[model samples]
Target: MHPLSLRSARLRLVAVAAAVLATLAAGLTGAAGAQAAQGCEVDYHVQHQWPGGFTANVTVHNLGDPIDGWDVEWDWPEAQRVAHGWNAAFTATGDRVNAEHLSYNKAIATGGSVSFGFNGTWAGVNRDPFAFRLNGRTCDGTVGEPTTTPTTPPPTGGESAMDQVAAMQPGWNVGNTLDALGGETAWGNPLITEELLAHVKSQGFNSIRLPVTWEEYMGPGPGYAVDPARMDRVEQVVDWALEQDLQVLLNVHHDSWMWLNELGTDHDAVLAKYEALWTQIADRFKDHPAELAFESVNEPQFTGAEGAAGDALTEELNLVFHEIVRGSGGGNDDRLLVLPTLVTNADQPRLDALKATIDGLDDPMVAATIHFYGFWPFSVNIAGFTSYDAEVEADLVGTFQRVHDTFVDAGVPVIMGEWAVLNYDHNRPGVHQSGELLKFFEAVGFHARDKGVTTMLWDAGQFLNRATLHWRDQHMYEYFASGVTTRSGTASFDSVYLPSTGAITAKSLTLHRNGLEFQGLWHGGTRLAEGADYTVSGDTLTFTAAALTRLAGNRAYGVNATVEARFSAGVPWRVKVVTADAPVLSSATGPSASFAIPTQFKGDTLATMEAKYADGTNAGTATWTSYQEFWSNFRPDYAAGTLVLTPEFLAAVTDGQPVTLTFHFYSGATASYTITESGGTVTGTA
Candidate 1:
């Protein structure tokens, strides 16, 4: 039996329903001389209702007079309780509820309205409240005819593919789950749940790219029948996402490299299997809402094919998928279908090849897909490229521009199916500096929006923790979420380094205000005074010496305080005040396999390390670059006050040859040490 098959019988039965109820409570009719009485109306819509919970949207109309602020007051006729509300500040006293206007939606002009939504729960009965008041004016209790939610399937030929993919902007990938090699949980992610989908929707993502691997759960070649249980599991997840009103991008994941890559050698057999697999998938999801889309493959590539041949092979597979899905009956006829370039690369040739395919297909419901992970060295923290610098930014912008020109400019929509720094997949801190990582995501979201491309973050239990279901780093997630629609002010770095033992001096940082106005500096809830605490000269923010002294209380090591540089829009930039001094190293001798230098870091954090031989050639691992790979060749264990040299780095060194190592710290301090490898032994001197 398949691993995913375990939950086939336990699939939750979701009840889908929608209702729009309106009530007009007329205010008291006043005398002719009296000021016009205030009157209002309210529209409560049940957008989605399940068994225990439902999501609703309320609109408040001020019919009488213009008001600076408004609040909607209502009582739960049943036992329904608000669980989560948005677009309003909600307060509940017993069964009575007040939905007050937020800062952005406070004003309600005469004849204008404001809307808010919330998810609520009920034990047995869920009834709509008939009586409502807006700013103390009664909205009469004359209930309009109740209308059911629109259950019409998405048009098979009316809506264009561009519109379909556009609705899925800022998507997320459910990576390493169904796409895991052996089984769903083989990659350490838990089973998919409706609660997780709800959480994702609440995080502001509009769609989910679900990558499924079918090879492991299928029978022998001729039939290539996918296990019914696996199909049921996939449908269950897809239905859950659809029920949450989220677009679903379903694709043949991992299969691209698993057996599907042999198309060149075993063309007939591979094509047959591919056809069979997609046929089954299409049949299973033929009638699903148009919110569900099908992608040809994940990073399609051919094993023995190269260049144009590989491109041709991918094109063939995509065409086949498009034909099969479109030919199938029901909603798939006009469902948005996505195709990928060779290896899903955004290079000119690959994009051109995919564009040619889309052009020849003569179908308006097709989208091209590509993947981005920024520059490789910076992405994986190798070759001394640690920051999200000019080179990395250029790579990002250049890729998006090419894809835009290739597909988007020509009226073909593109989907960035997968993106994120590769090192982030490890979920390890310090692989990429915190500021650089945030900057990378910020740029990714900005450029994706700028280029009019849809991007789906590739997460495999990294960005969002699977067990806790919470963002691993809330601030980083904020940058990603905010970057989708607005620009945020960032800085050259996220920290201000001050010497622990030296006199305090004013420190300045360059701000990358991406077209937003700078507000002021803030520490927690209190805003710092501009002239005394800090000063802004152009893009540089200078923290006065007095402010630094006060912030660095006792001049302790590591981070002392954190402050936010608020901006006019988007997420605010965070700056850490850190106090550190030069690190010290102590020499020691040990086996070449396990050698560590005892180090007193004092108050500094290591950035990168450079190793070179006496003759000026690169030493140890990664000889191509004098700056060795971080964590791969050396690691700083600040907790243990030691820096360990991995066995691979030592083994690559010439026996009896001394290697000079320069360790760079984040606080502008460097320490030099010499290590000699002899036979199976190693000795170091500082």
Candidate 2:
């Protein structure tokens, strides 16, 4: 099936970092107490306040000796209470509050700082704490007196870009919506509504990245005016998101590759059109609140310009965008502008170029943005990367670290504009296995938090079922949500496969403690008896043969039981007990352009397929690797009881040559077959 077709079918079926301890203190109290040889400095800024609720960011700067662990203490001037917090452990007694460091951010070097944030509620008055004590000692130095007021006005677009983006943690993208090829609903999603935005907020997203394609809605060159109705619709969505208190990230999406990419060949015309587009956008939302941010382009690329030329073109466009937005009056003057690297890639050179552009702009209201779809091979389940192994994780960490050191550490914020496994578009039974997908997300959340980069999940319709208005995989969402604040224990795999026709044997999984202590295992609500039902050896959890037999009731096919591996904190990992057997393949004949192998799965599920020539060289599409791309060159139609090879694969093979095909199933069962293409016909033998 076509990748996009599978995406459509799935839709239809369901449907910041440390700023050197200075700039973060803007508009808030600085260090208190006298400047002693050994003291601390605390910068507390109320990020957002509304009615009885407000969010504040606190930075504790150590001005004394280096410490291994530290805690910041403050007293609320009113009856305000912290409802939730991140980056630290918060505890309150009456009016006093203490925020302790977490396992990751527990150390503070002399003259260094650590930051955390929390959401609080108040009664008649909400006043800033007049004093802050670090490790039982009062902070030294002061910027201004604590304000005594019940209400602080909303952000006035004057907040620094870094601070603004910091408040926009855990963002969600409304993908394939306005950016849909034909129209808003052309991509199979329902019309954008306030309820949808509200639902996103309810899911813990503090921001929404609204991707828009304005080409079809724009007039001919010169004026290149955006359709008023289209502008109205975009404004409507932005306003709805803002109403839901979600920071809206509006951007020119697909248009980047549509017409914007022509900048290299049609420089003048493209520039004129680009300037006109931004001019219209800026004028329309000029008066919007600071919560509304604008991004220049989405994964921008220029045709006919591959190297420095392409970089120059992207830089020029960003400069033009910045000028137009800043020149426009109202909130646009100080609004946060998010600029991206070439194709929004995190490569070192790309990040360096973008950094130079931001630094050259000399504007503190500008932030860097990039897109991550993970390493190519693992992303699409191509080659032999069928799991989220070491290579996959290294790629993720390296990319985030590059962006962090380049932008975040330098006091500029970074926003990961679009991130998600590319295979996610194919939905369940997709190219990626379930356990690997979970690990990918878990790592993404943890690393992004560790690097202080705001991430926006790219969801077309697979994640949240627009029709049902609920997460299709609630457990996966839990993993993501938990990663925002703390780490969660995960296992090497999510399932244990047992032969349905043979004696069940003990199965073991390596538990990834992730710094959390593992609790006992539970089947439903009952905890399994240790040593009898299961045993833990270091990080490995082993289930006894007797336990497996009992769990796989009647040796049934598919999942027989489900259990949860509980940890000290974060979401619990779920393990599935499945029963399967060796698969059988039969010979088949068809045209040289198409072929199929009749198969009895016997409760087994296909994982990856490998094709090779007699000489042992790779065969079929992606000949660089023995394992062909899933769902591309080959796929198993479980319902049809046949493993069909796509015409693409058949066409790539040499006629009169026999090729060896190996099918790998999730149940550890493998089946081999031989296929020969002669003239216009193909024959297969098991």
**How many backbone clashes does every candidate have?**
4, 4
- Per-residue accuracy of model 1 over 1-686 as CA lDDT, tens digit each: 00111111111112221111222221222233344445566777776543344567787777666777767777787857775455665667767788777556788887888877776665456678745666654464322221221122212336677877876877889989999988889999999898898788766677899999999999997999999999999999998887666789999999898899999999999999999999999999999878899999999878879789999999999999999999998998889999999999988999999998999999988899999998988987778897889999999999999999998999899999999988665435567788888888888878888889999999989889877889988777767666666667789999999988768999999989888778888887678999899999999899999999999999888999999887765677889999888899998999978799999998788888899999999997788888887777888887888999999999998999999999988778999999999989999999
Query: Each model's TM-score, in the order given?
Result: 0.80, 0.79
Per-model C-alpha lDDT, please? 0.81, 0.81
Residue 86 CA error for candidate 2 (Å)?
16
